[model samples]
Target: MVINLSPVYIENSLLFANTLVMLAVGLTLTYLTTKVPNFAHGSLAMVGAYALFTIAAIMFGNQLSQLQLAQPLGLGFAAAFLAGAFAGLLEYLLVLRPLQKRGSTPLGLMIATLGVDLILLGVLNIFADILRGMNPVTGTTRDWRLKAYVIQKVAGLSLGVWISFGIMIGSLVALYLLLTRTRFGIAMRASIENPALAQVLGVNVDLVNMVSWILAGGFAGLAGGMMAFVQRINPATGSIEVVAVFAASIVGGLHSLLGAVVGGYVVGLSETLLTKILSDITGVNLVTYKRAVPLIFIIVTLLVAPEGIMGINWRRLFSRIRSRK
Candidate 1:
């Protein structure tokens, strides 16, 4: 029997996939440049989500639920991006840079990011509480902590859906242009390929690392802000979702940004679709196991090809196909 998919499910899956893409790309960039898998990347997104809330609070008084449909969404987006970038830069300068200067290994750096993640998570929790209190003492039907501004729709889909997908496309296109068409992009590529050699060739490796962190953080924050509108934003959910981000990065080939983007959508769709299909078939609520989907992806990818999607030798496959023909 064919089971019809709901448009809501399709929209949610696509929206989540696009958000995951932004996150995975940022993580891949940081890894390629710094050789450190930033565990705190998700927290940056959480921070961005809070930043968006803060912007809304400022614009529409302490309670974000009070925000009207006429409020400018652009300001919230800009605030989230800048807030995430700043947080990333601060972490690099304060924590990661100091560790690197002390001759820390990749493992050490990764641990340092975990520590940073914990610190950021704590801060986010406190900040969330503050936002929760922004609502007046008088009882109101609205909830600031779970405030969702989702009126303005385009062709029946929420504006956030369009903006998130647009950001996903725009980020990838801009990244391609940056890597292929700009001097800094070339320098970044060189640094990623061989930092020692690039440094010897006059490429400022330090500057490139800083820029990568900023960009990664900005993207993460953007994803977080978009996700807040897509779903509820809470501090507890921040680190919980990092598994999916890491899974996407791994399935995409941690070293390949292209792989990360592809893996993100693959994992994102699996997370939603698998649970949905299983639920329909078994007539049981299987959505609770949605988190396991990414882990399953991670295990399968590792077992089949640890190098991930981009790791496959396409040229070799093409040559073999031609020989068979």
Candidate 2:
């Protein structure tokens, strides 16, 4: 069968996948370290997107070209990253940390994250309203408030594309190195695996948790900022994709970083490709129901292999095959 795919669809799918990778990594990392499914993770990304918007519109007037070395964008990126990290740190320090001290259950911590998510979303809406009142140099207040923003192009592709790809690649490399080559990484792994044991070994479990939240928050922020340029940026932008991000993490094995990365690509492609193929074949517009893709993945994964793709023991399977042979 000849399955002709449009280049635009493919490019968009990759872009979406890359974005999911960023968010999924953060979700998985947070879950690994805290053992809580942080529903507020996506809100942290949304905060980062707004940080980019604030820098580009209010701080720099959206005329970054006049700056040398594109420092404005650089500053904006830093601001977004920092904002995301701060949001995460704040959530942990203010809510999760206190709750942990009081011996809160994992389910309670997870519910707290939901509360944080609602609060953050409300704050974002208020911030957007404030932006709606400000008159920026670029366009109308509404335009500057929460509309889409695009970066300059290089080699005919928007700079946002390169930025997103760079963040994903750089994050992967940095995380791998941090986990495998650094003392902190070792501490983090020990803490995640056994907090009591790690603390006994002088690993500083609390410190590890703080650092992980910071890193996860930073990644989400960077992704959100890059995504704001590629798509529309509003208060709901981050919350809108939480399902896909969660699916990526869960399908990859919530405890496995590599699995999360692979799952992000899988869900990303399925969300786009499946919708297109099914729409074309069934003569029905399935694009509107694309959001259900992740839900389906979640259900299937729960039924078939609750541990997810990475949870499977490949070595044992290979050993059994060899023994039979």
Candidate 3:
């Protein structure tokens, strides 16, 4: 088994892994709330990335080239993270909540979200065009290599790449603590399980959903912001990442939280490692279908383990666990 790998592959793999993790988590929040598979989640991530980009441009503005978000990191990253949260909140208010109030079906909500995605992308494109004129070839919305972006180091490993991994780990840890150790988490879980039951128990379902949307959006934004410099971003960049993310989430198990994170890294490795091999193997222009690597992995997972690597019986495994002998 000759493993042809390199530092570049590691960096790229980590990048994708981080992104897939964010997308999966974002999708998970929507899935929990409305039981809908939102195609628009990708769009939300994309828009948040742009928002972070704009805010960072103001905060950094060639001073450091990358805003780490507050002194904790810098104002840029913090702003982007918050921007993502705001984007999520906005979507819930504008698209999800509106339709939900009128008794819209999940499918209908999905469709409306899709429309919102397109509309938002259009708006971003317009914004980018304007920025291109003002900055004139400095942003990702324009050229691929106008200027060098991203800080080289954090506590250690290439700050730009590892920041995302840090976020992924941080989010998972935070989510774990929240879900297992707080009343709010219990209410959220209850809402995820049965909204009506939660409502009966005095949980504010609507407010809870709004908060979930905000948190999901914030995480997604953080992921996108983290990757913005790692990859050349455009208005449609989020759309490109959509494949890897959904595949990872599906691989992890549709509604299982931990499964989403595990699935993200698995999909990440496949794309980063398998892609390197496949390109050398077939020698038939892997560039055209490079993105398909995750999609193929997803298709295989769906066939082999439709229930996902975590297994389908989440209720029994995660919740019940049975009595110990």
Instruction: Report clashes for each candidate as comma-separated counts.
Output: 1, 0, 7
Clashing pairs in 3: 68-73, 68-74, 69-74, 69-77, 69-78, 70-74, 70-75
Q: Look at candidate 2 and give me any clashing residue pairs.
A: none
Query: What C-alpha lDDT values do all the predictions have?
Result: 0.83, 0.82, 0.73
TM-score of every prediction relative to native: 0.89, 0.88, 0.85
Candidate 1 Cα errors over 4 Å, as ranges? 61-71, 136-148, 282-284, 314-325
Rank candidates, TM-score, best first: 1, 2, 3
Select the stronger candidate by TM-score from 1 and 2. 1
Against the true structure, candidate 1 has what lDDT? 0.83
Q: How far out, in Å, is residue 9 in model 1?
A: 1.4
Cα RMSD (angstroms) for every candidate in the order listed: 3.5, 3.4, 5.0
Q: Write the per-residue lDDT of candidate 1 for residues 64-98, one digit (tens) a residue.
A: 45335346467877888999999999989999999
lDDT for model 3 comes to 0.73
- Model 3 CA deviation exceeding 4 Å by range: 1-3, 61-73, 136-140, 143-147, 151-156, 281-288, 312-325
Cα deviation of 284, candidate 1, in Å: 4.4
The TM-score obtained by model 2 is 0.88
